[model samples]
Target chain A: MLTPEHIRDFLDEVKDPEIPVLSLNDLGVITGIEVAEDGFVTVRMTPTFAGCPAMEYMRAEVEQSLKRHGVQAFTVQMSFSEPWNSNKISEKGRKALKEFGLAPPQPYQGILVLDILEYAECPNCHSTNTEMRTPFGPTLCRSMHFCLNCRQLFEQFKPL
Target chain B: MLENAIKDLLYKIADDQLILGHRNSEWTGFGPMLEEDIAFSSMAQDKLGHSLAFYTLLHQMGEGDPDTVAFMRNADQFHNSQLVELPIGEYDFSLIRHFLYDNAEILRFESLSQSTNEEIAKIATKLKGEVRYHVLHANTLVKQLGSATQESISRLQQSLEYALPFALGIFEPSKHEQELIDAGIYSGEAALQNQWLERISAVLEKTHLKLPEIANLQPVYGGRYGQHTEHLQPLLDEMAEVFKIDPTAEW
Candidate 1:
C-alpha cells in the first residue's frame, strides 16, 4: 500500500512540459487533491485557460503519477469559478523559471510596471534590443525575436 | 451596411463577449476541481481579449475606446443579445451556454471572414483560431457530461430548462441584422438561429438529456442597445473605477 508521502514524492518529479524546471505543484496549477479512504484519488486542477492546449497531457501526467503510487480509480476535475492568473504562480516557481533561462512574469501593480516588452531580452546573449516583427511567436507562449547583437532568432514568452 | 449600422453590429457582438466573459470569470477558483478552474479562467480572459480587439476597431470608427466601449457605455448602448447577459445558474447551465455560444461564434467568425468590410474580415480571420478552440472544449464537455454519471445528466437536464431560452437569444436580431446580411458581412439572424439549434440539438441528444419546451425569451435588447442588466452596472463599477477616476490614467 502506497502512502500519501510516496504519492507526493512521485508527483514532485513530474515537471511542467513548458517550464521543465518547476513541478506542476510549484506552478500552483495543482490546486487540490483528495485521497479517499479506499484509495480513490481525485485531483482538482485549473488550467491556464479553458482552451489551453496543455490540458490532456497534464491530466494524463497527474493520473500516471498517482497510479505509480498505487492509487487507482482516480478522477481529474476542472473548474473555472475563480479563474487562474499569473498571480497564482508561486514565487518559488517564478524563481525556478528565471533560473531555468526563462524570464519569470513581472508582478502586476495598479500602475507603473516596467515589465519586459520593449524587446524580449535574448535568452542566449541577454541583449535588450531584440524585437519581434510577428505577434504570433514560435509557440503560443513565446514569440520569435531577432537579436540585433547576435543576429540569431530566438523565442521569448509573450505577456498576456 | 451603413457604417453606423455596422458599428451597432459590432457593439452587439463585442458586448455579448465582454459580459459573458466577465460572468464566466466569476467561476475561477470555485470549480469542482483545479484544472477546470484554470481552463475556465483562460476562456474568460480570451473572451475579454477578443472583445477588446473588436471594440478597439469600433473605437477607431469613433464609437469609444476599448475601456469606454466595455465599461463606460450605458447598458442601453451595449446591444449584446440576452444570451450573453443572463446569470449563470449552475455548472450544467454554464456548459449549456458554452455549447450554444462557442459554435455560434465559430459560425459568426466564418461568415465575417467573407465580409465586405476589410477590417471586419481581417479581425474575423484572427478570431477564427480562438473560437475554434472554444467549440472543441465545449463539445468535449457536452459529450463527457452527457456520458457521465446519472447525477451529472440530471443536473444538465435541469440546466437546459433554464438556459435554452437565453441561449436562443444569440439570434435576437439587431437593427443591422438584415443590412449585415445584405452587405455580405454576415448571415441573417434567422439562419444563424436555425444552425445554432441544429448544432445544439445534436450535442444535447448525445447527452441523453431532455430538451425543455422553452419559449425563446424576447431578448431584452439592453446589451446591444446599451440597456444592460443590473449585474453589468456593478461589474462596470468595479472594473472601471480606476479608469473613470482619471480618463488620462494609463493602465
Candidate 2:
C-alpha cells in the first residue's frame, strides 16, 4: 500500500522554485497529505505568503505526482487561516537553503511585531555587507539583493 | 456626496488595494534582500489591510460579509484599476509601479483624510501613517535605481512607459464623480489625474529616465467595471479557492 510516507518520499525529490535546493516537503509547502481508504489523497499546503506565484504550479505538480503513482481522486487544498512563516519549514529545509547558497530567514529577534535588523548576512561568506537591490524580488516570495563584499547576487527568504 | 455613490467609489478603492496586495504578497519570501523581502510583503499587507478597512465600511453599509465582499465577488464585480490587476512583473517594473502608485495613493489618501464624510475621513486618517512609509520607501528605491547603471534604468523605464496608461486608470472617474466633488467627498478625477502626473513626472525626472508622454496616455477601464487582465484569474482562483469551496467555513 502506498502510504503517506510514500507520498512524502516522492515529494522529497521536488525542489522549491525559490530555494531550488530545498525540497517542497523540506520547505513545508506540503504540510500534510492524507491518503483516504478510497485512494483519494488530500494534500494540504500553505504558501509562505498567500500570493506566492509558485503555488499554482506547485498544486498542479502535486496532483500529477500522485496520479503517476496510481492514486486516484486526489486534491491539493491550499489553506490560509493559520498562515505560513519561516517556523513552518523544518530544520532540514533551513540547513538545505544555507548550504545551497541561499540565506534562510532568521528566527524572530524576540520582537513580537518587527525585527529591526538593518542588513542580511551574505549566504556566500556570511558577511553582513549585503544591500537590498529590489524590495520585490525575481519572484513574489523573495527580495532582490547583492552582497557588497563578494559582489555576488542572492535572494533572501523574507520574514513572515 | 450620495451614499450610493460613495459606496461604489469605496468598493473601487477597496478592490484595487486588495487585488494589488494579493499580487504583491506573492513576493513575500522570494525577494532579493531579506529586509526588502519583508518591506515588499509589508506593503502588500498594508494594501490588503486598507482594503479590508474599506470593505468593513461596505459591510456595515449592507453590501455583504467582508470576506464574501472580497473573495466571492466575480471577476466582473471588482473595481480595482488595470495597473493593480496586472501580473507581478520583473523587480524593476514592480518597483517603478510601486513608486508611481504609492505617491498617488498618498495624495489620494490625504484628500480622503479630509473628506466631508466622517467614515471616509476616519479611515483615510488611519491609513495616512502607513501611506507615508510606502511613499518614502518607494521614493528611496526610485532615487537609487534612477541613479543606478544603465541596466537598472532601462528596466525601470520600460515598465514605467508601458504601464503609464493603465496607471492613469487609478484616477478614473466614478459614475457619480460630480456629486462626490460637489459634496466635498473627493476632489474628482481631473484634479486627481493632473496631480498624479505632476507627482509621477517630478519623481521620474530625478532618475535619468524619460517621462512617458503624459498627454498621450489614456486610462483603461478595469477597476470600476470589474474587467481585469489575464493575470488576475489564477491569482483569484488560488486566493479564493478555499473560501469559495465553503464560504461559511472558518479556516
RMSD of each: 20.7, 11.5
In model 2, state the lDDT of residue B81.
86
After superposing candidate 2 on the true structure, give the runs of residues whose Cα lies further than 4 Å from its correct spot: A1-160, B248-251
Worst 10 residues of 2 chain B by lDDT: B125-134
Which tens-of-lDDT digit does each residue in B20-107 have in candidate 2?
8887788878877676677778788778767877887888788898788888777777788888878777888788778878888878
List model 1 lDDT by residue over B1-251, tens digit each: 38978887787778878888887787887866654555566678778867876787888798757876676766555667666766766777887787878888878877887788888876776566556556756776878888799999888877767667666667767777777788887887778777777787787788788766545344433445555557666766766788789978965
- Identify the CAPRI category of the predicted complex in candidate 2: incorrect
Write one digit per residue (lDDT tens) for candidate 1, span A1-160: 5455566567778777866887877766676677788877777876554334566578788888877766768888754333354556778877786577665544554421223333466666777776653323323444345779888876554443
Each model's lDDT comes to 0.68, 0.75
The fraction of correct interface contacts reproduced by each prediction comes to: 0.00, 0.02
Best candidate (score: TM-score): 2
Error of 2 at B101 (Å): 1.3
Error of 2 at B248 (Å): 4.3
Per-residue lDDT tens digits of candidate 2, residues A109-141?
A: 443232222256688888877886654455544
TM-score on alpha carbons, each prediction:
0.60, 0.62
